[model samples]
Target: MELFNQIFVDPFVTMYELPDLLLQTLWEGFVSGTLYSLIALGFVLIFKASSVFNFAQGIMVVFAALTLVGLHELGVPAYLALLLTLGVMYLLAFSVERLVLRHMVNQPDIILFMTTIGLTFILIGAGELVFGGEPKAMITEELGLPTGSSDWDVFGGIVIFQHIDIAAAVIAFLLILGLAIFFNKTRIGRALRAVADDHQAALSVGISLNQIWVIVWFAAGIVALATGIMWAAKSDVSFALQVVALKALPVLVLGGFTSIPGAIVGGLIIGFSEKLFDLYWGVPILGGGTESWFAFIVALLFLLYRPEGLFGEKHIERI
Candidate 1:
């Protein structure tokens, strides 16, 4: 009975007694989910365009952030460093298309996937050599992001909201909006969609495969930079940020590999579920440390029921 009470009854009781804490936990989850969605968005862009599972996306995030910080450390202004980082990402995209994907064209999917894994190693080695293996603080003020917090008193308790968290949420929403417009309304976006639908057919219609690959990769790089800055602000910019890539796999699974909106929704689901479970049950009963595997377990269960994910269309592949 004690175990049952602790498992089911006590957490609810605590939530009821301290509603503000519950709200605070939810807000934190939302912030985390937003970041997860941003990372997953990078994956979707590459996969949708090229049908390649780019395993290097995580390292790309760390590399982009490190580049920005490294440039700033060299006495470059924050905004100038940001522009330089974008230029670097564009060059990377172009070089990748010219030197890597160009030769790998018409290769098997497995081959493309392996190529990305190799790219991941090269990026890691290069990043470590250039930036060193030390963690650096995110220059939040230099980038003009908000700092400090706001507290709300309600239901006989105080709920604290960090300004940076609020800014992150708003920026994430705007990014999504802009991406939707870009993909749906622009000529380049139409070309991208065509390439995604059928590469050969797109090529037949005069759509340049090399150009599309460069554009898609460059777009993914920009998303990585945004994700890096936000994530580094929340924590420290470090090679350890690469591990968050593992965490993002669960989000991708939950959201489906091809659906953008699904990524956002799936992230929120994982984020909220993990946070609430850790606070209410895991810490109290399981001796803590549940957040690490919580999202994966949920994703596994979700996939068992709806393999296509919540928003992804069902793909019926006839053998």
Candidate 2:
């Protein structure tokens, strides 16, 4: 009975007693979920266009951040560094499409996956050589992102909101909205969908597989840069940050590998549930530190019940 009370009753009691805390927790979760969705969005973009899992995406985030910071450290202006970083990403996309993906066209999925794994190592080595292995602070102020916090008094208590977190949320939302419009309303976007459906057919239709690959990869790079900046602002920029990027795996699984909106919804679910569980039950009963594995467990349950994900299309093929 005591365990049951601790498991279920106490959490609700705490929530009832502290609505402000609940709101605060929800806000933090929203911020986290939005960033996770951003990272997962990179994955979705690449996979949708090229059918490659792009395992290097995590490292790409770190690399993009490192490049921006490194350029700034070398005396480039922040905005200039950002533009240069974007140019670098575009070069990477073009090189990848021309050198690696073009040669690997029509190859087995495993081969493409393995190629991305190799790319991850190359980026890691390159990043280390270029930026060193030390963690770097984000140029948040230089980038003009908001700093400090605001307090909201509600339910007879205070809830603190970080300005940077608010910025992250808003930027993420706008990025998602823009991408949705681009995907649904642009000529290249239709070409991307066509290539996603069938590469051979798309090529037959003159969709330019090479151009699509470069565009999607470059788009993924842009997402990586944004994710890296936001995440580094919250913490520090380092190769270690790539591990956190793995959290997007669960986000992708929950949201659906190919659905943009599903990624957003899935990220929020994981973010909210992880924070809530850690605060209410994990720390109290499980001795804390549940956030690390919480999302994956939730993702596993989703996999078991709804492999197609919330917005993912169910595929039926004759066996």
lDDT of 1 by residue, 93-150 (tens): 9999999999999999999999999999999999999999999999889999999999
- The reply for model 1, stretches above 4 Å from the true place, is none
In order of appearance, the predictions have TM-scores of 0.97, 0.99
Report lDDT (Cα) of residue 44, candidate 1.
83
The alpha-carbon lDDT assigned to residue 266 of candidate 2 equals 90
lDDT of 1 at 188: 89
lDDT of 2 by residue, 88-152 (tens): 99999999999899999889999999999999999999999989999999999999999999999
lDDT of each: 0.91, 0.93
lDDT of 2 at 48: 91
Error of 2 at 142 (Å): 0.4
For candidate 1, give the lDDT.
0.91
Q: Give the CA lDDT, 0 to 100, for residue 167 in model 2.
A: 96
- Which candidate number would show the highest TM-score if scored against the true structure? 2
Give candidate 2 regions above 4 Å deviation: none
